[model samples]
Target: MRRALAVLEQVRDHAAAEGLSLTELADTLGLSKSTVLRLAQPLLDTGLLSRDRRHGHFRLGPGALALGQAYLAGIDLRTAAAEEAHRLMREAGGTVHLCVPDAPHIVYIDKVENETAVRMASRIGSRAPMYCTAVGKAMLAWLPEDVFAQVVDAGLPTVTTRTLTDPGLLRTELARIRNRGYSVDDRENEPEVRCVAAPIFDHNDVVVGALSVSGLTSRVTAARVRELGPAVAAAALRVSRTLGATR
Candidate 1:
């Protein structure tokens, strides 16, 4: 059983590296193509690999994604943000995101997609515009005024026509965000994409990350945006404090 599992790992690794095929696996593993298939049968049963996307190109399947996400979910954040993320998802029935600063952009560390009839692109690991995105602005609004200036000086390119391209306009918007303790995307990143985000603070009361709920613009109107803003912000603050973040 252990040996069989090892063979699957070899196939997965090789496939990831260079699209493993029957002939390749047979030659590399010194087994017959038939033998390779027989050995790979378990992974197929587990839905880890799929029939060649093209004629005979075996590749990863949905099960592989599940496994990867499971691994990610297993890691404990230095705080309780994940619990908040789960709660937000359950309560809102909309996609919830948890992100952390990753230099050039914020990295989506976690995402829970809404099970609604309508959906949006809210995937984990997605990187988005720092100036125009809700989570980005939420974090940005809490920074020192000098740091905010630095972000402006760093150049805020227009991602979408609706994105606030003028640094002065952005400054004003950020000010509003700071005042409200929340931020709005308003289709700034992608056309028809709307998001509401709130800043997360650690034990030091310092802003560390943010949380958000995003959906299509058609679904999230101005009033709905106003309604969700406080919820997302509250959730973020709750999680931030749970993470020992204070400000």
Candidate 2:
């Protein structure tokens, strides 16, 4: 069963449009052509894989699209992220935010506040720029190159003295965020406010949102940001898994 699913995944990844030859699938899967055929037989029988008549190459069939549609239909981003966001607020002792990308901006969909922590100005449904805020940067780091370029082209306005207003600098910062698995807003979006955030992905392995912990700079100091980064990242990963992200 696993081998059959692997075959489908490989075809989906490498041959969705153009399709792949049996030999190619065999080489990619490190299996002989006969063995690849044996594993793929069930998928073909179930209408998950089809051979192009003209090219005789394998491609994802309509059954795959049906499965994808069903999976997406069952997923609700806010509900999927709620528990993890609350747990992050409790564990990190700060306000937690769930935000989804909105082109040059991100919209806060949920905010979990620690009762004892200082209340943040951000409210659910509020919008923030993608260049300066931790949650925005977290989503941007994993988004496609064209989307990132569009945000840069739109503008990188200064929200605070620490905001990365320069395009080149923001690009470098995004690379760092990808390397560390989280992003930091060091008083960039709001004065005396600091935040650490990580990207959340869906079953398609596409970044759909971000999870963040925000607090006053005095309490969430530079050292605290470093300490909280990985924990925030782990929390976001759990949310992603609940959304059916394989990665």
Candidate 3:
């Protein structure tokens, strides 16, 4: 069973347009061609794998797509993210937000507040620009190039004095966010607010959402932002793992 699943995973990982040949699969799985064939037989029978008669390459069959669809149907982002957001709020002593991208903006899906923390103006279902918010930048840093181009083309309006309206600077900041594994708002979204955020990924290693710790500038200072960055990133990683992100 383990070997069969490994074979399936290898095929999934190498799922190019032409798929993989028997020799390639044998080398990748470190098994004899006959052994690899034996392992793949059951998968082929179950419709999870298919071999091209002409090219002799193996590819994922319709069964794989069905399994993927079922898995996506069962996942609820807000439910999967709740515990980590609450834990971050408790430990970080700030408001926590779970946001998902909506092209030029990000929509807040869940918010958890520490009782003693200052209340933020943001609420569930509210939208914020992608250029100035930490949660938005966290996701933008990991999303595709076409998505980034779309955000830039939409215009980076200045939300506050600290907001990065220049495309070049914003691009630099996104690169930094990718390198550091997190992003900081630095009072860019709102004059009195600061936030630290990290991206959340789904099973296919796609960026699906973000988690952030938001607080007043007085409480979440420069030093505090630095302190919270890695912690926020670790908390977000836990959420990503729950969603089955391998990385």
The estimated TM-scores of all candidates read 0.64, 0.74, 0.74
- Name the lDDT value of residue 184 in candidate 2: 96
Candidate 2 ranges beyond 4 A from true positions? 1-72
After the best TM-score superposition of candidate 3, give how far the Cα of residue 240 lies from its true spot, in angstroms.
0.8
How many clashing pairs does model 2 include?
A: 0
Candidate 3: minimum summed lDDT over ten consecutive residues — where?
Answer: 67-76
Query: How big is the positional error of residue 25 in model 2, measured in Å on the Cα after superposition?
Result: 21
Runs in model 3 deviating more than 4 A are 1-72
> RMSD in angstroms, all models?
16.3, 5.0, 4.2
Better of 1 and 3 by TM-score: 3
What is the C-alpha lDDT profile of model 1 across 1-247, one tens digit per residue?
6645655666677654656777876777787888778877877889887666576656676898788667546544533677787788777667888877654467787877767626666677888767888988888887777767766777888888898879888888989998998999988988977889998876557777788888887777899888898888788877765554444
lDDT of 2: 0.91
TM-score for candidate 1: 0.64
- Specify the highest-lDDT model's number: 3
Q: Candidate 1 regions off by >4 Å?
A: 1-79
> Global lDDT for candidate 1?
0.76
Q: Model 3: how far is 28 from its true place, Å?
A: 18
